[model samples]
Target: MAERYAISSGSAYEEKYGYARAVVDGDRVHVSGTTGFDYATMTISDDVAEQAEQCLRTIDAALTEAGGSIADVVRVRYLLPDGADFEACAPVLSRWFGAVRPAATMMVVGLLDPRMKIEIEAEARLTR
Candidate 1:
């Protein structure tokens, strides 16, 4: 059996929700839906684009700790409550994923907090 590991962002919600920021099982890393809040400051921005950037920053940290890089990402998911916000976030998304070009999906759905304009999740296979 493959060994499993968990990484934490130290977000309050992780304890409240009983989850880790990301989990590594064998060579694969699965990142949880990450919001815009900077876990260190517990602050989030109102602008969706800024929020999108923060999400990637948070995910990147998790990925690096899990022994993977953004380039190793095989899949990504974007979640937002407003469809119009997608366009605002596109440039940030493209900046991160343009070269890697992972399988991607976007969905407009209610988030756990209204202030959270966006949430992102990702999956990566560690490079051998």
Candidate 2:
């Protein structure tokens, strides 16, 4: 079995939830559902597009720390409470993933925090 490594974004929730933001085992890195809240400032934007961008930023940071890049992502999952909000986030999603074109799934689901407009999770394989 490969050794497991945990990555942290220093978000308060990680401590409360008892889970790392991302984890690495061998060549693959699995990032947990990331939200729009900026962990550093603990602030979340009301705009869905902005929230989507923040989700990608948080995911990318975790991937980078795990020795991968957004380009290495093989899968992505998006969660939004409102189905209509999906359209608002398409451009932001495209901005980060338009070229990579990883396998993706988007669904309408209620998040733990009502202030959260979007949540994103990703998986990446390290490439040397």
Candidate 3:
């Protein structure tokens, strides 16, 4: 079996820690938890909706690089700093997942970064 690892742009996986953004094995790609931080500015949006959008954008980029697309996603996990933000960000999430309705879970938790109110993680399979 061949194994491969990847680190997406704007990610500090190797520098901050020592992990790849995604690891590929066989037909599966396990993407790491992705946050909505603008790589260009190294800043995170204060709004939950914008943050969610940014998180999905980052996840999409990782999926694309891993020989997968949003359609190939099997599951998604969302972490929100406040439970109240769920409704505020749900519409954005629905729009992003309108076509690909993968299994999903959203929860409220204290995040590693205080300014970050949302983080998203996903798993996808390589198709063809």
| RMSD of each predicted structure | 0.7, 0.8, 1.5
Q: Model 1 has how many clashing residue pairs?
A: 0
- List clashing residue pairs in candidate 3: none
Candidates ranked, most accurate by lDDT first = 1, 2, 3
Candidates 2 and 3, the one with greater lDDT = 2
The 10-residue segment of model 1 with minimum total lDDT is 63-72
Question: Which pairs clash inside model 2?
Answer: none
What are the lDDT figures for the candidates, one per model?
0.95, 0.94, 0.81
The TM-score between candidate 3 and the true structure equals: 0.91
Alpha-carbon error at 101 in model 2, in Å? 0.6
Which segments of candidate 3 are over 4 A away from where they belong?
none
Off by over 4 Å in 1: none
RMSD of 1: 0.7
Q: Write the per-residue lDDT of candidate 1 for residues 32-116, one digit (tens) a residue.
A: 9999999998999999999999999999999999878899999999999999999999899999999999999999999988999
Candidate 3, after superposition: displacement of residue 110 in Å?
Answer: 1.1
Clash number for model 2? 0
Over all chains combined, what TM-score does candidate 1 have?
A: 0.98
TM-score comparison, 1 vs 2, better candidate: 1
Residue pairs with backbone overlap in model 1:
none
Query: Which predicted model would earn the best lDDT?
Result: 1
Which scores greater on lDDT, model 1 or model 2? Answer: 1
